[model samples]
Target: MEKFTLELLFHIIGIGAASGLIYKDNSLFVIGDNSGFLYEYHIDSQDLKRHPLIENPSENILKKEKPDFEALTHFQDSLYIFGSGSTPKRNAMVEFDLAQKKKTDTKNLTNLYEVMQNFSSIKPEDFNIEGVIFEGENWYFFNRGNGISNKNTLFKLHAKKLDQEFSMTSIDYKLPKIKGVRTSFTDAVLVDNKIYFLATAEDTQSTYHDGEVLGSIIGRIDIETMKIDFTKKISDSHKFEGLTVYKNDNKTIELLLCEDKDTEILETTIYKLSLNLK
Candidate 1:
């Protein structure tokens, strides 16, 4: 197995620490944070630009006691943001068009709040969306169930019909139970017919305020067999959050892993891992 190497470090303050990344092209990457901020950065130049897609400029939106679980993805030339918030403001999936010159705001595509209002049987607090990955006509979402449980659940959203309600279901993969460990699957990407995920495993032996113990691993989930193979683990202090496959010269495939953490305080670094699928 090949190890990941740090390529660059970026300092972005008050960004609420990035949680997800989406590579639009060879140059541009869209990053999302817990603060509802979406930033566009250049890979080649290493230049950073910030855009607040869901800021409450008027201070009208209800404030929460804790940070929300935010994630982003790009599909059909538009950026999609997903997160969970307070009541009447529960979890949501939104879309933004980046092609426009003006800063684009997020539009509610899937409103868990509305669903909760209509269906009293379903609770809004139960939804905690972490990340979203689009595969063909299906969009897979990773939801971290209330922090109390170690279960990292996956939900399927049909991309073809936006008007249709999103159906929540459990993924077949069984997560390993490690004592004193709080594991949550965050983001995922598809490469060579395999699904690679980024997850967080917090050591519960330490206090919740003691800071998160983060690590990353590369795994392959065979769609046909519904089996997962966690073959390689990334050894680095920087938490791996997002990943995208890019083609270098001679058509060689390079995997760019986005390190989503505060640079000034945390060991923020992006790693480039070369894949040799045999």
Candidate 2:
């Protein structure tokens, strides 16, 4: 793995905290951590549309009252959005139908999240789930090491069911530090057998509070071995939290990333990251 190039694509107006991203059919689906709407940005036309994920008003949702959607993934024909589960108020899973362009169902993941907390022995304050991806009959949940414990972990859950009988295995990782702050997982995308993930170095010991951004890192984990192949620093100014693959070839991979400035600004920028795969 080698250094990657990044380009500013365009700005997504009115979305302050773009935490999750997914690209499909020439459009980008964005989820804001402090918003009640799911946004669709057309790449070719430069048009943006907002679909309400819940009954509340889209952008007016308060920060403390928002669902804090931190991860997004497309499976089958629907999009699954998950909360960070850092707090009791952030334990919701929303399923949006792609064809219908509406939220079909929302699941309260309190039980499932509690099970994870108990199994990993992570305190409620340290259990911040920042990313999730699925392959075959397994779903991988990423726990950010931004809290007091600073434990970055990957929880693999067998997809038999989301009940007490389901099996789970965890792997802990120690990410590189940036500007004296250790980086932690923020988002991930699975390409073939390799999982590409984003980690950001924020100067905060509490999960509920915002902090100074040190930088962001991109890394790859080999699924077969469940180990990291490489980690690279992509940016030293922006705290990118969302990532999705736009295109990939034999020598290069094109990815789109979204960032949370940790401010009240009502706009977010989408960046293009090109990785050299040779």
Candidate 3:
């Protein structure tokens, strides 16, 4: 149990954040935003420098009217961007090549348009994809779960083969009901083989009407047992939207929490948390 200290802040509104420490000895991170822009940031001099990655070409080309960058993850030297709205022709995970600096292709795993046309329980508009994390051979997607009900849902998508069509299945997990908690699950990370997620919760009935005040907490998910232990709570104004684990010199683990200041018009901040992994 430890508190996070803010390291650096960048005023960028990103829907989701993804980072990877690869063999190049360079730390890479990608931030996807509502404006259909993906900005790549490199860690240098203890600051984040925005490097242009990719952006949606035109609104007319997209299926839905508004294409939001909801989820992001890195796999096989490529970054995957997922969302509900995308170009009508390709409305799934858009793969971006890190070395080429361009979008290679798109994969429509859910067939959102077709799913909405036929299904009743799910709809294209109801899909609010947020953050993604790779665990084992499967990639878990965290959905904001329909802005109406705000039900937290995790979708497991198999991505063992890049060219293979991914099959998605839902997993069960209960969102914490804390007083003044407004937002649902935002981001997840694996630490010591355990999954920990960060979410924002605020009072919907508050008179202040200042949007949702950000709060954070950590929960561990047992993969084998299919159980979530949310006993640890983190209360901070920084709204955590992404997390990454790093090893220190002494072989200790440090969790890097990324904050999404989308609504507040604040700078994006990253916090480092020293954890006691026992």
lDDT of each prediction vs. the true structure? 0.52, 0.89, 0.53
Query: By lDDT, highest first, what's the ranking?
Result: 2, 3, 1
lDDT of 2 by residue, 1-278 (tens): 88689999888777888899999999999998988889988889889889988775477467688788999987777888999999888999888999999999988999999988888888899989899996657888999999999989899998833443678999999999999999999999999999999999999997789899999999999999999999999999899999999999968999999999877788989999999998
Runs off by more than 4 Å, candidate 3 = 1-24, 45-66, 84-92, 109-126, 159-168, 180-183, 202-210, 248-252, 263-266
Clashes of 1: 0
Give one digit per residue, the lDDT tens place, for model 1 in 1-278: 35444455344333334567666664545454434445666766666665655555211122342234356666676776666432334345556677762245544544544443233332344445556777657676665433444435665556554556666444634454323454455577766566666665554332122245555556556655546765455543455666666543423446666665533232234557665553
Q: Candidate 1 — which pairs collide?
A: none
Candidate 3: C-alpha lDDT: 0.53
lDDT of 1: 0.52
Best-performing candidate as measured by TM-score? 2
Candidate order by decreasing TM-score: 2, 1, 3
| Tens digits of lDDT, candidate 3, 1-278 | 34333455334333232222221234546453433445555555334434333353421122234344556667666777665332342246677777876778766655543443233243344445566776548877665542445546676667674455776666645576556464566667655456767666654432112246457666667655647854355765655666666554334456666665544232455566665544
Clashes found in each candidate (C-alpha, N, C closer than 3 A): 0, 0, 8
Query: Cα lDDT for residue 139, model 3?
Result: 76
Candidate 3, run of 10 with poorest lDDT: 15-24
In model 3, pairs of residues that clash are: 62-87, 63-88, 180-202, 180-203, 181-201, 181-202, 182-201, 182-202
